[model samples]
Target: MKRFHVHVSVENLDKSVQFYSTLFGQAPSVVKADYAKWMLDDPRINFAISRRGETVGVDHLGLQVDSEEELLDLRSRLEVADIGFRVESQIGCCYARSNKHWTTDPAGVAWETYHTLGSIPTFHAREEKTSTAACCASDSGQAGTFNTRRETTRAKHCC
Candidate 1:
């Protein structure tokens, strides 16, 4: 099975966490200084929030699969849909190790399909000291108007 994922960027992490916890009727499963996550099973959504300096709104949407096979299945469907997509192998982020496939909806909303393998100590858990440049290596313009070679702006979200 796969769970829906939503990452939202907020100005106040503490307030946002409190709001979400009350709204969800439960506390976040993981809470960091700058990030918090609620692994809710009732709605099966991997909801996360961060204190990144992005627009205070929905950051990105995603589908979190339980295994590589499920992740590949989603990837295959995206390929068959003829939409441009990019895959990052074992690119760790969000305090977990995950392989991700990224694409943008027609409305310029970014979508990620990933299978998180395990937890990591750092938010950007990659081999070597991951430069902000390498962590968000989106292919071409499929991932919206970001990750261009000239623009080394790191993703505003926690991941």
Candidate 2:
């Protein structure tokens, strides 16, 4: 099975969470000091919001899968299209670890297809403090930087 994923950066975490909670008619499934996620089964969507000093709007869109086979299927599609994409193996972010691949749509919107492996304590693990340019492969979405964090631009300067 697969779930639609949408990540948005907001101005206020609490306020946004409250608004979304009310709109969704339920509280978030996972709430962090700076982030909140709603794993909605009704629509099968992984909707998440974060307050990381970034612009307030839809950040990136994705498809979250359940198994490696499903992920491979998505990858094959991207390969068939000959659309360049970046693959992050076991990348840790958004309170979970996933094997994700990123590609941009015709309009420059990022589309991340991934299979979640497990949960992690931190939103994203820090390792040797690499530059933001090295995090994601590509996707020149609205503001570039692939929405990794608001402080940084976005998804590592698109492919």
Candidate 3:
């Protein structure tokens, strides 16, 4: 089954984790030093949060598919719906080898639908710099300017 995923940026990771755990009536499935994620079965949501300065809202929203075929199917459906998407493959952002379809909603919130192919390699400044440049080139027309701060934060924390 597909899961609706939401990643939020929070000022305090511990506080947010406690609040969300209470709200969801369960603890998170994954927790790192600066991040937490809950794989909620009842609502089928993959909710994640990262501690990043003072930001306290959605970083991005997305759908997580089970396979590459499902990801392609979603891309096809988006095309049929007359929606434009920016696609990326094997891009090392948010700590994974994700094939993602990026787009903005009517309200202008960025959305990413992705299937993570594998974990990203260890942190390498040159490699990350290259990936960031490539991702910008890919999404320039679709998302306008990529928020470098947020992208860098994701690279450091979420990965």
Candidate 4:
């Protein structure tokens, strides 16, 4: 099965983790000094937080596939559609070892397509050295506004 992914950047990891744990009614499954992740089973959400800046909200949103095959399929589909992607390997970010494909929508919000390879020990910013850009790369608009309608519709019908 797939998982709903949300990444938030916060000023304080401990504070945010406390707040989210209270709201979600559980402690994080993975927690580090600068990051925390709750792999919520009840809600099926892969909620994660990164302490990068002073911001207190979403950094990006994405879907987590179960296998490498699914990730490759997605890459192929995006390639066919002429959407570019930035790929990253096992650099420590978001509290795991993941292969990620990053794209943007009409707005500037990032959409991560990822497959988790394994767990990591630290929460460090991922250094992406690749030159490839993903779909809608030039747009500077935020992602939520562009995808809100579709998200709401999916929530109503599919969820």
TM-score of each: 0.83, 0.81, 0.72, 0.72
TM-score pick, better of 1 and 2: 1
Best by TM-score: 1
Whole-model lDDT values for every prediction: 0.74, 0.71, 0.66, 0.62
Clashing pairs in 3: none
Question: Model 4 lDDT vs. the true structure?
Answer: 0.62
Instruction: Choose the strongest candidate by lDDT.
Output: 1
Candidate 1: residue pairs that collide = none
Candidate 1 residues lying further than 4 Å off, grouped into runs, are 126-135, 138-154, 157-159
Tens digit per residue, CA lDDT, model 3, 43-72: 999888876323568767889888999998
lDDT tens digits, residues 1-159, model 4?
A: 778898787777888989999999999988766667899988998988766433457667888889988888877876777665556555345446676666666665667777887764544333234411111122222222234433322211100
Give the Å shift of residue 148 in candidate 3: 15
Model 1: lDDT to the true structure: 0.74
Positional deviation of residue 93's Cα in model 3 after best superposition, in angstroms: 3.3
> lDDT per residue, candidate 1, 1-159, as tens digits?
999999998889999998999999999999987679999999999999876545779877889999999998998898777766667777667788788877677776777888988888866655355243224454323432332322333354334
- Give candidate 2 misplaced runs (Cα > 4 Å): 127-153, 156-159
Per-residue lDDT tens digits of candidate 2, residues 1-159?
989998887888999999999999999999998789999998889998876423567777899898999999998987787776667787767778778788677676667888988988865645234333323432322222232332244432211
Q: Clashing residue pairs in candidate 2, if any? A: 139-158, 144-154, 145-153, 145-154, 145-155, 146-154, 146-155
